[model samples]
Target: MTAQGAFEVKLEPQQDTDAPAGRMVIRKKYRGDLVGVGIGQMISKRTAGGTAAYSAVEEFSGSVAGKQGSFTLIHSGFMSADRQTLDIYVLPGSGTDELVSISGTLEIIQKEGTHSYIFHYQL
Candidate 1:
């Protein structure tokens, strides 16, 4: 079986001044009845001139027959001044937990232009 859908997400930066950057807690709720569970990874980099970029990857398992299907997601990109572009990958699962994969990228346009380091995510 195959399933497809789109989602909107909101992010908030919890700790911005920590080394290697702090974790941005994500709270995403989808519309469909299907439920999903997974893990995610985030990475941040800073330059000499106080510029920074960040990326994230998430792997999830969806609800299935008395169980749940699984997926692996990889999102990466850079942010400069305020604008950002993120590349996303979604890999669907097989019976054994791996199979077909779909990928896409999202252009994140920052409305409030500031370097205060408070980021918010909404989906």
Candidate 2:
């Protein structure tokens, strides 16, 4: 199934300008088919060759498609001069309540200053 929603996120930098790893605290509030809040942290840094990479883990709490439960999301992202790749997935064995055993992935879309999510999953 798929759940659609809009979310607002706040990212706070957790390190100085020259920190080897740029750490950030991520907080999100979502509305629509998926009503919940997510808390996560991200660590990213630029390589000497000018490439960059980051990874994050977020826990989402509340309801998904009317199912009362929670799950964790994992994020992996990479950037280079020619391309960028980002992958977000539901962490296995991290589901609770009705969402137990939930598995799948999530996509984030941004348009005109608005952020939305497309979550495709199976229980």
What lDDT is reached at residue 29 by model 2? 98
Q: Show where candidate 2 strays beyond 4 Å.
A: 16-19, 48-50
Tens-digit lDDT string for candidate 1 (1-123): 323333335566666675666566454433233355445657678787666777776654564223444555556777677675666644333223322332322233344551111112111
What's the lDDT for all of these models?
A: 0.47, 0.93
**Pick by TM-score: which candidate is best?**
2
TM-scores, all candidates, are 0.47, 0.91
Query: What's model 1's overall lDDT?
Result: 0.47
lDDT of 2 by residue, 1-123 (tens): 899989999999886677678999999999988899999999988989999999999999999988989999999999999999989999999999999989999999989999999999998
Query: Model 1 Cα displacement at 16 (Å)?
Result: 10
Q: After superposition, how far is residue 101 of candidate 2 from its true place, in Å?
A: 1.8
Local error of candidate 2 at residue 96 (angstroms): 0.3
Pairs clashing within candidate 1: 8-123, 9-122, 9-123, 10-121, 10-122, 10-123, 11-120, 11-121, 62-69
